[model samples]
Target: MDGVSPKFVLPETFDGVKMEITGQLGMIWELVKGPVIVPLLQLAVYICLLMSLMLLCERVYMGIVIVLVKLFWKKPEKRYKFEPIHDDEELGSSNFPVVLVQIPMFNEREVYKLSIGAASGLSWPSDRLVIQVLDDSTDPTVKQMVEMECQRWASKGINITYQIRENRVGYKAGALKEGLKRSYVKHCEYVVIFDADFQPEPDFLRRSIPFLVHNPNIALVQARWRFVNSDECLLTRMQEMSLDYHFTVEQEVGSSTHAFFGFNGTAGIWRIAAINEAGGWKDRTTVEDMDLAVRASLRGWKFLYLGDLQVKSELPSTFRAFRFQQHRWSCGPANLFRKMVMEIIRNKKVRFWKKVYVIYSFFFLGSGQGAKGNTKGLKKFPRIFKLPDRLNTLELGFAAFLFVCGCYDYAHGKNNYFIYLFLQTMSFFISGLGWIGTYVPS
Candidate 1:
């Protein structure tokens, strides 16, 4: 015993101990599985089913609201005070509110001319309109091309300024923020923003500016996007479908009912006062447009969606580009939600329902829509391959129907209170799962 413990145990004793330990561990596992594992699995299943049901209900409710919206939604001119601006006889185009157009681009070799041309051609008084081309292109050749395009437009009697920053600090948001810091931007009462790919109509300004001018309460006038190459490929087609739903159903409904909707990054006009009051732009999240919109909404500002005022734009035709776009679209809002949920909850300026709509409907549903396309819901099943496809189609149809229904609901409520609850716990989970799946690299 003094030499070390002469052998601690006999082989037979060790074997007995091992057997007893194994039995105890097995019993513990069984108990754990029965009470803990099984219930967790069941809870997961229930959550999935509940989410499916909630999304389905949301689709239905949106369908009904949008349908009614299309049939009877009044034109903006009818709802808001609007009047065509005319030049003063002596001053001649000097009385029009100075408007600033911002085009933010980064190495956009292909669409630079188109966007610049479209903005230059806006039917505002030449003396009153100023266009800012925020070029963040890293490629020297592309930068040269974009700057040349701006010069070409400038030579045509258009008041255009080509702007470049030392670095892309905040990506698009940073460029936009810098663009506003220019001394000339202060003289402009209203600002219109277009991405490099957007080609607004000639009358885009005439159509959009009046809403901001006539209504002091309105912060933004967001226009619908029309993709010229929607039929280019399957990917673009899917994008078109989703974007159409976003513009038609989601944007329209939010504008009609709540006077709120996320400010799409492009093809929109903003009241400079509202932007200033909303603390300008913060580059905290990738979805800077949505971030600004939420901040503006919380400050008691309203947005107007112009469904008929369509602006031509292009969708990402490649899978790689689409994945990146979807990732930003999905993740930015979730991050923004996490960042601003408390700010939204504590704001005393907005009503209870509006806060819910922003948190539940705008943030959740908007983020969910981006992830919904890339989800593989029933990949585990081989027989019912068409189920997810059918559900997607049904959802799109519901969105289409709801675009029409939002028109109806706007004109007539018709027991559509349920629409308020369409997006709830289920949407939050879908958004989270979708965000995780799309961008988490393999």
Candidate 2:
């Protein structure tokens, strides 16, 4: 006490006072928590239930929209269909309008040859078609392979150009824009794009270019993607189902309803005029394809999705790759959504429905799709003692039927169940630390 400062020394009664206060607070907490804890839990559960209901209603509305679309949605009629080997006399010359085929590649050694070769083999008039391979591969060996492949195609009398940049400044999108700068590309009226892995059919140019040539207002002709390795594994199969829905129901609905749908980047043709008008490809967001499409749409350009024309491609074989792909897919769209929503709303050219559709889609289907739902304590149930197989099937079927009447999804498929299982397996909670401060009751 003699060595201690007056402020540092405690009163003789401090210990007793502290003990009494602590005990009193502990007793109060116990009493409050007993009465409060259960109701708080019940409140959380109720909130979860409400969110689930909202999600279910949203799904039903989507289902209803899809059904309505299927009942009566028609794509535009082709004024003139393109033939691979044959000539179109009405298109002026045998070669007709020049087309620039751009293949953007980056460390795609495994699939570059297939894409380049396919692009070369595309049955357009030899002189009229110009194939551009935009290789941004850091791997010198891969870059050489791509160049050699281009040379091989060129030697065979195919009009192909191999392009490289000192730096991948804009990555894939930058490479594409650089490819368009060549002197030969100036004559090209329309541009067709394929990702490095996409193995488009020989008739790709013929099938996609007709719409562009026939309709001056049409800015892009997007083709559906077909996964060649869809049967390789469960992951690919699930992706296949999901993509099938996207191409068929979602795009179909978008086209029919005149709501906004976007380019898949690869396997789509863009008019050079439209590209120029829309400010070319800006790498402001990860999704340059969709960004370009939206801008073009806002500029009074129409996009046509050809459902009948399918371009085969590979799906991500590994989960790590798939997760990265998901990140890009989710984050890019959301980024673009954030960047473009206000612009879209303010744009007088964009239809009201289209704006709403884009907003809702970016809000609900962005990264939020991966956020698992309100199963709560249901995950603790024994996995081994599941419902009987037959009963499970019957119950699922009944649920599906009931949902169909109200409009929603029931887990009838094995993959659907697997997804639920995956979600359960991955669930955990982290307590967020916050400051405990005094507050007045509102």
Candidate 3:
């Protein structure tokens, strides 16, 4: 009797309670879905569309400004005190400014010799020119090879030094910084940087040095990059086109209007005084070049970009390498913006418009023109209807117009131009995905 009594009946109410809770939750979601969730999503879409329009407007505005400037812009020689250096026999080799050529390498086994040879072959006085090979290769074999190459150049009476460090503390930035600390470099009036892949002409020094030598106010002389392997693959060809646009339009505009542009990290010469005044290179971000340029500009230092004086360099051939390169190019600027926005705002040396240009036009947008387009395609293209149809049509029109202009410029008789145009279009779509690929964890 006690055992039977202990087996009390359990309430069958659990299923009913869960069903009631789920029904209430569903109702709540429906209630908030229209007013709260939908509006929030619509607001996000609107914001994205607005950003896209702003970027598009800036692109167009810059284009117009470039055209107007080219109409009557004074050449550097006209504005600055540019006197061509006479022959060594006439002017004397001792009168030339001492230059420190720094070639930074990191396991670049294939191109080290080319860069070293090109630099040593520069048409400058042997006594006045100092070539520094900053080899930060972790691979011992690569390090040995680079050192031997430097020694080989040294045997030819070239004043080239082979430099190594205990560790790659700041990566490329640290190596460059250390290279400047040498006792011999103190004698140098200017410093030129070359990446491992770059091969400058023998007269590179003869042409670029005059700008820095003549213009005391100019902090840096940035040269254009010409890709040696642009025809190697479709990826390389696309990169060539994108970079061509950057050097041709953006750099030219910056140099002409603001007297400023990002130091392209290599194939550029920096006055030693300007480098010290800007506090040298800091490794706070991956983009040491842009960081230095910003700091230097804030200190009232100006930069010059010579579009005609192009230095030959190799582009990344593989997708994996290209992805990493794009990640650095895209993310580093954002990171630099985050760090330097306040500094830029507080600087009194630069004018108000210069500050605006740096923050709004340079860092906020990006060095590459394609990033904004790519970003828009990724974020705003799907929900583009959040904005007016007219706005979308305007952007499409601009794109189509640019395409037509490019065809007119390059597609006269060359069939390769057609292939290049198609590759560029393909490049745009694929690079748009990089916005996602770059940030996502590998």
Clashing pairs in 3: none
lDDT by residue (tens digit), candidate 3, 334-430: 7899999999999999998889888876676784442533333323234434554223332344345546756775757454565565555445534
What's the CA error at residue 193 for candidate 1, in Å? 0.6
lDDT by residue for model 1 (197-230), tens: 9998898888788788889999999999999988
TM-score result, candidate 1: 0.78
Which ranges of candidate 3 are over 4 A from the true structure?
A: 1-28, 88-91, 367-442
Ranking by TM-score: 3, 1, 2
Candidate 1: what lDDT? 0.80
Which candidate wins on TM-score?
Answer: 3
lDDT (CA) per prediction: 0.80, 0.74, 0.81
Listed per model in order, the count of residue pairs whose N, CA or C atoms clash below 3 Å is 20, 0, 0
Over 4 Å off, model 1: 1-31, 375-442
Q: Best candidate, lDDT-wise?
A: 3
- Best-to-worst lDDT order: 3, 1, 2
